[model samples]
Target chain A: MLFDVQGTATDFFTTVTSDAVRIDLGRNPGLNWDDFVNRWRVAYFAAVAATPTPAGTWTSVHSIYRRTLDALLDEAGVEYPDTDREELTLAWQRLIPWPDTVQGLRRLGVRYTLATLSNADVSAVVNLSKRGGLQWDAIFTAEMVGAFKPDPATYSTAARYLGLPHSEIMMVASHKYDIRAAAALGFQTAFVARPLEFGPAAEADTEYDDAFDLNASDFLDLADQLDA
Target chain B: MLFDVQGTATDFFTTVTSDAVRIDLGRNPGLNWDDFVNRWRVAYFAAVAATPTPAGTWTSVHSIYRRTLDALLDEAGVEYPDTDREELTLAWQRLIPWPDTVQGLRRLGVRYTLATLSNADVSAVVNLSKRGGLQWDAIFTAEMVGAFKPDPATYSTAARYLGLPHSEIMMVASHKYDIRAAAALGFQTAFVARPLEFGPAAEADTEYDDAFDLNASDFLDLADQLDA
Candidate 1:
């Protein structure tokens, strides 16, 4: 089974926001950290949307994160040193897993080969997996494929590396778009619901969808339902 | 650290020979199994040497094993069924690991990311790793890179995936040719001595080369010296 790490396995939103709170450089307690974090994520989404064509030169997720962070900090009037920005951006690599993530993955790993097929850069994913104590049979990334998720080449590249047909490999992610794209390409799809991926106050779309091969509330639920 | 899996981590010679012994369809006891195994290894080497250009059509190691087995059996005047040939060819994916491999890799993993940079097919390496209890942060192989080891692209592809410079990532292998090739490309080289890689009766090379960045008797010794 191949997993998408950012939201499905680990809570990047909480982790990055907490780091912003801890390293409050120019922020007053009156400042709404949640709103600021939400804006930062919005900017990230916009940046990804504006990414160059897959055939263009490679731009790492680390570089995108750094650029997005600089733009967000400037807009928030939060002055920060260059070194602080680098550390804060790197928080993505050290995000903590959800309560059920590790155990669920361990159980599933006993029955199936577990791997990470993430948009995160390969080095970042490697660090994240090691930090989160996740054991993957293999780790694949957009950097290796030279294209981000939802790109046909990205899914096809992973299928090629795993030496499996698209029909045989399962793509598990919290995002519907990711699952939809994989499904269109004949890959098996599992939709994992991470209700608070944006934040605690945000209303997440956690409803089950019939289009997905499997809809799960979390990793544990998914593993149990799969009889792993 | 990137590792060479076939000989450095697992004893493929013993594994394949034992599999042959178990499925003795047309074997004569007087026929030396060690000699037959060495011939198989030589055929594998020739097959790799004769591999088509990286950009050519994909050729899996498993397919190469079956082809070579057919030729070897024919030469030895041994008749085997197609089913038996397929089963024996898959023994490459179920090789046993060296005694110190697992522990040494575990210790080193605490400090540095561990990955495989093998000539084997990616799926085969993944299966071998899972079966042998080898814990790797990432799995890379010739199939992923579209070229075998000693190919400049193979080493460069691994460095690209790791998002590290050639100098920062170390290439650990038992084969001198692999080390020399990687060293020329500026990768840190570690020569791990596996005395019985060919077989118990074969005089395998285990010399410590001063040219290499580090040379040790085994994975554990290499780990100890690296202070990982």
Candidate 2:
């Protein structure tokens, strides 16, 4: 099973917003960190989708995070030192896994080879995996594929490296677009709902749909459904 | 640390020779399974070195292993069914780790990120890691790099994906050639002696030399030397 690391395995919404709240505690008591974090994520997704592919040249997720953070901070009228800005940008690297994530992954790993095919940079994913105590068999990323999620090259690159037919490799993600892209390329899709992925104010769409091969409430539920 | 999986971590010689002995038990009592396994290793090395890279097409180590096994069986006058040949070639996928491999990796993983930079295919390394109870942070291979060990592209691809300067990522291997190649590309080199890498009948070159930055008897010793 190939996992999408950002929200499905690790709880990025809580981690990032918590970091933002902690960093901006005294300076901006009125700031809604949850909204700020969600907006930042929307910017990230847009930036990655719009990032240009110039053949040999590469743009790292670290740089993208930095760019998005600078723009977001300016738009929000927030002031922070360069070091704090760098730390805030690096919050993605220190994301914490959900309560059921580690045990569920361990159980699933026993019966299946579990890996990450994340949109994050390889280094970011590596650091996140280590910080979250994730035991991934392999880490594949947009940095390796030279493209972001939803790109045909991304899924194909992962499938090629896995040496498995697209039909045999299952894509598990909290995001519908990621799974849809994988499904279009012949991969099995599992929609794992992270209802608080946009924080408490926003509820993610968790209703079961015919589009995905499986719908799971969480990692543990996914493991149970897969009989792992 | 980047590890060479086939020998430094796993006891492939013992695993392959035992499989050969079990499979060819009644077929040839005079056959030296140990020697046969050693020769097979040599053939594998040669084939990987000689595999062609024609632009975008890939040559997986699994295919290389199959090719080498067929040639070796023909040369050794050992006739086996195609299914048996396939099983024997896949012995590489189920190699057992050395006694200290798991414990030492756990110790090292506490301090430094540990990954594989092997010549094996990604899926093969994933299976071998799972079978041998190895907990690697990431798996990088020749198949991912589109070339074999000792090739500049192989080492560079790993360093690039790791988002680390070659000097920051230590390359650990039992073979001097593997370490030397990595060292030439500025990767820190650790020579871990696997005295039985070539089987008990053949003595491996275990002498510590100035060429490598660190030399240890085993993974545990390496962990101690690194203060992990």
User: Model 2 - which docking category?
Assistant: high
Tens-digit lDDT string for candidate 1 (A89-140) = 8988888998899999999998888888898888888888898899899998
Model 1: DockQ against the native? 0.76
lDDT of 2 by residue, A74-134 (tens): 9989889999999998899898999999999999999988999998888888998888889
- B156 in model 2: Cα distance from truth in Å? 3.0
DockQ of each: 0.76, 0.80
What is candidate 2's lDDT per residue for B122-195, written digit by digit as tens?
88899889888899999988877777888888888888887899989999999999999999999999999999
DockQ of prediction 2: 0.80
lDDT of each: 0.88, 0.89
| Winning candidate number (TM-score) | 2
The TM-scores of chain A alone, one per candidate, are 0.95, 0.97
